[model samples]
Target chain A: MDRQRFDYLLEAYGADFARWPDGEREAAAAFAAAHAAELTEVLQAARALDAALGTRRVEAPTPDLLSARILAAHKRQRGAGLDWRAAAALAACAVFGVALGYGGGLLAPVADDGDYFASAFETPFADYDGDEG
Target chain B: MIDPDADLVRSAGAGDAQAASALVRRHLPRMVALGRRMLNDAAEAEDVAQEVFLRVWREAPRWKPGAAKFETWMHRVALNLCYDRLRRRREKSDPDAGLYVADGAASAGDAWLARQRVAKVGAALAQLPERQRSAIELVHFQELTNIAAAETLEISVEALESLLARGRRALKAALADVAQDLIGDADGVPRV
Candidate 1:
């Protein structure tokens, strides 16, 4: 890599070779080896920033409580999801039961052919009783 | 992509409790670190990390691989959470309020000096425009690959490089006085 590309790589990845893009790293490293003096100055400047950036250390979450909380939350969410699925399955079963019952009734021999039309009209009790008398 | 966590992620998505725990344990530290660096508040960072894990739990079952690496997705979620807090901070900005306190107890010695330097660098970083600061944090501090960081930021690699260049230049300028302290030699060579 030329100085321009090398500088760009330095800016993009700081002074860390491992952080640099894979393909150009060899070229960049070779250039650094070739132009040791110039590269050292640039590398130093980048490293200073990297060093300063490194100083801010964030404490990891306390192992016991944090992990427990995370897993508990996971379980709670999964449980809720399961609950919904269970409810859905129950509803589906209910619908299927009603459908199956209806279909079975339809498939069975007709108790009365007039049964279908029987519910279509409502007759006063007096008319039925008078006709029977 | 060959995600190291792909197996754990798949197991977690299948509702394996142990797998879920493993995934949480695996990714939580980096998420917390990213949150802390982006937000500069330990408690808030923890909250962000928790929120990220919570999302993971909810989405894991529906998680479809080949879309993106799980850790990359986690970073995106964590960054988004940080951005939300940051926006809230801006809205509630108070001139009287200090953005950051001294990092720790100050005492005479190199330790205190080191803390001071870190604080100075932090303050400079905080002063940068949010995008520039984020670019620097993701690539430099978080050690995300340029491509991954760009994906996290929803920007092109070239744009990310531009931001890095600008961010680093700004950082150097901001810490110009401390440059000598950073590297002892005027030629920018480290004494070590």
Candidate 2:
């Protein structure tokens, strides 16, 4: 690896060679062996960083309350308002909507309001006038 | 290679109680750690971890393993939860601002000094922009591989590295005095 690429990896992954990307590990090691002086500087900086940052121990104990709460939430979801029957009913409605959208025209075309009006009006003014007379 | 959690996830999805419990136990600590670092509150972190597992339990049956590692997905969920809480905090103008600072009043000796450094680091971390803090948290603290961390943040590996570099620089700048105290002697040499 070149100096620039090696520096980038050093900044990104710190001095721990194992943390470097697997593909670049061999090249990185080779470069480190060749450039011991620069590697030493980087390692020193990374070690200081590790020391400073690692001081605070972050512990995440599995509290019984948290575990119980999580399990209870899961169980509640499983048994809650949206059971299989409700899911099936929702699915059936969706299927009905899709079927209507695709095949409704084949069963019956919607009549035109203008055509119905025109046919009724054309039924003869004469008949209407005679009846009025 | 198949992820070790693939089978557990499948069983969990199939409503297997033991498998679900195993998955929770396996992933909760890291998820909580991630949330704590991101949110800076242990109680809230625990809540976020619970929500993440709740989501896992609901979505497990439909989990497609080959697309990504289950742990990566879990990290994503926890990150999302943390982000949500952060947004809410911002909306409220940080009513709980003091929650981020750990109690450091009662310590003595090296323990006190070490705590000061940790508190400074944590404070500096909290001061960074959200994405940079997340990048540092995922890589430095969560110990996710760069590729996995990138996937968790939904960014490229290159972008993730860029964020890390910037975050590290900012951290070094913010913790300059603390770093000096911890490692720098009067002559810039390390203390024995």
Candidate 3:
């Protein structure tokens, strides 16, 4: 790994370098002897990186997170349909309330005209209870 | 509600409330993973992932299939979200989550031996740049093809290669020591 060749390898492979070709093995070995100093620096730096990253561990997604995710999936499955049902239910309730209120208002004239009807009946111009029985 | 991915996407696009939640769940993991890799923090990753999924789910009706894979699209959505996160998110969080290797006492067994070697490799992998980390995870670790990985990063093949090369170089530098430690004298394998 001469300075020039080493630089080329470093450039060619960098941190993402792959295993050398089988044919390149003999050549690399020969070069290694000629430039052991450069090889050591590059190789050691690479090793330290590997060691550091190797020791940093991560567990699989936690059981709680998995369960939570699944639960969320289920909730989503249940939720979209519910929105429409809720809106429909709300609309029905609104219509029902509106109709009820309108009908109540319509009956107000009847309630308010009771005195007028009673006066007319008492004057003998109309019958309040035509069939008293 | 229905299968969030399909049902909500269909119904919610047609304007349904319940569909939204289903969509959220369906897309959450990728969002989280994207965020995890981008921000390198679970809590922050969750937040960013949630945001991405929510934004995409809102537009699910407009989602056209055949143009892209669902997972790929989700990844794109996430990477973009993570880009934003990377811009503003602090780097104070833990490093073990993003691109990392396993750690523990290698017990006296073959499995331990394999783990010891693999761990060294993983540690070496961790020292890579985020783009390199992403590429390696996409290519080597996750087994995604170059094209697929490229799509996820929205980069061309050549660009992906560039990222991969740098990543590999970093790994080579990092792992050389472990290789030396394991290999015996004259860079030979150590005696068992």
Candidate 4:
């Protein structure tokens, strides 16, 4: 990295090499070390700004209530999805049951009430006569 | 690119409470931090974080990881929410919109000074243009890789660097005094 490029990156990313672009970090570090005597002033300025920016601390303490609320929302959505799926499954089962009953009825032999009564009468008197004998 | 959060996101998407909770635990703080930096309001920051997660849950089941990582997408959503809120603040033109309110409880000398310094730095950050502020926040505070941060902003890495440079320059100028104080404090000089 040339002086111009190094200074540009330094100003942009501050003194922390970790913050520098991945492709240029090693080259920039080498340049800095090689010209430490000359780059001290610029590097110090960048570090100073970094430290100043660091003072603006943000404490991100996640409130339990917020977490619970988010999780609850997720559960609620999932629950609704499950409810829909369950309803669909029940409907499908009902439809299948109806179809099976209809299909079985169609496939079964039809019984004649007339034939049943005739056969019953045909056997009724014979059994009675035999008992009497 | 292999996303580290892919497994978690998939499990969470499939209604795994443990996975969802883990996702929340891992990303909630960073989301909150980004919002806090952008909006400079704790309550609103929490709102942004919650909103981001809400979107996450909504999209999780259908979330197809494509170009961006899940974390990067979350950051983009959070940033857009922040930008929307910022735009609304501008439309309403609230005088106290970006003001950094120091804690009234910090009465101790050192604590008060530190709070003052924080307030100053925050105000300076607040003054930056939205893109510039976002660039600095992502690179400096969020510590996102350049590629990730650039994707979050929907900008090229070169443009991201430009924004960072401009943002840092403005901040450097604005926070010069605070920088001096910090440097002084670091050098063993007593903070007055």
* Native interface contact recovery, all models: 0.52, 0.37, 0.08, 0.71
Candidates' lDDT values, in order? 0.77, 0.76, 0.57, 0.87
lDDT of 1 by residue, A1-133 (tens): 7888898879867887888877887887888899998677788888877766665655544446777888999888778878999999999999999999999999988757587567555555435655554
Give per-residue CA lDDT, model 3, range A1-133, as digits (tens).
4567555444433323333333444666677678778677775554444334333334335334643554464456457657879999999999999999999998875645778777766767453556758
Q: Which order, best to worst by TM-score?
A: 4, 1, 2, 3
| Interface quality of candidate 1 as DockQ | 0.27
Poorest stretch of ten by lDDT in candidate 4 chain B: B91-100
Among the numbered candidates, top lDDT falls to 4
- Residue A130 shift from truth in candidate 3, angstroms: 31
Kindly list the per-residue Cα lDDT of model 4 for residues A1-133, writing each as its tens digit: 9999998898789999999988999999899999999999998899999999887656646789989999998899889889999999999999999999999999999879998788879876777756554
DockQ-derived CAPRI band for the predicted complex in model 1: acceptable
Off by over 4 Å in 3: A1-59, A66-70, A73-81, A92-133, B1-40, B46-62, B97-129, B179-188
lDDT of 4: 0.87
Report the TM-score of candidate 1, chain B only.
0.84
Instruction: Name the docking class for model 4.
Output: acceptable
By TM-score, is 1 or 4 better? 4
DockQ winner between 3 and 4, please give it: 4
DockQ of each candidate, alpha-carbon based: 0.27, 0.21, 0.10, 0.41
The residue ranges of model 1 lying beyond 4 angstroms of the native Cα positions read: A59-63, A88-133, B91-108, B185-192
Q: Roughly what TM-score does model 4 have, to 2 decimal places?
A: 0.84
Model 3: per-residue Cα lDDT over B53-161, one tens digit each? 5555456667665565656666666666666666675454344344333334545574455555554554455456667877755655344556667888889966886
TM-score of chain B of each: 0.84, 0.84, 0.62, 0.90
RMSD value for candidate 4: 6.4
